[model samples]
Target: MKRDMRKTEREISKEEAKDILLKGEYGVLATISDEGYPYALPLSYVFADDIIYIHGAKEGHKLDNINFSSKVSFCVVGDTKVLSEKFSTNYESAIVFGKAMIIEGEEKTHALKHLIEKYSPDFMVSGLKYIENDQHRTTAFKIEIEKISGKARR
Candidate 1:
């Protein structure tokens, strides 16, 4: 299969791409509904074991879209700064193509814990209690990455 096509010269290595994903605070997840409409939502996520984990309400448009179609795209932009004098911006970004599905049991709990670590490291005790209390109130999903590419303008 062919590799990334856009800005091939500026494409970064897999390691760089993964690094960006790990450090990114949020990402945009794109999905296609059953009616053929596309939807994109910005969400907080955790990158682990080469998979992307996201949590949300047990039911919603995102879940509906995922149920209708497994294919999805997620994008994360990092370290962006506008350079007015140069009329351009310096940035790093990564786009991931993958299949997503709701996870349950141990895997779901593990992903949730990872999220706590990433987002609330200082409140681990409270976070654990919160997870225990709300575990049934939320749903955790994992995206098994198929293809990912990173680019930079620095």
Candidate 2:
């Protein structure tokens, strides 16, 4: 279900939105808890081939929420500049609406590897070893993006 940006004038191209997603340092993943409350948490993620990859402990609140309902939203902010005098700020960001599917086996390995490449490029040797040793203790998610939109006040 794609929704139009409220501020059409501030909307950016899909390509630009993707660029922001790629360069973002971190993103907040939004999910619905079993209690019906919205749960949002910041996490390091990798955006690849139109899908977003995130990993976490196999058992926890986040995973519990995902298992309860696959629907979720993720947001990443690319850049910002405060305008204290104007009482506003210049910013660029992208939001993703998607269904999160837990991945395992080969897909999980690939996603984990991608995360390492993106966040721990300098520790690849050790990262691969870590994945091989403790992959079973962790879980990876693949977000099948249904709709994505970017906005900017630049």
TM-score of each: 0.96, 0.97
Model 1 scores a C-alpha lDDT of 0.94
The digit string of per-residue lDDT tens for model 1 on 20-93 reads 99999999999999999999999999999999999999899999999999999999999999999999999999
lDDT of 2: 0.94
In model 1, which regions exceed 4 Å deviation?
1-3
Q: Where does candidate 1 have its weakest 10-residue lDDT segment?
A: 1-10
Clashes of 2: 0
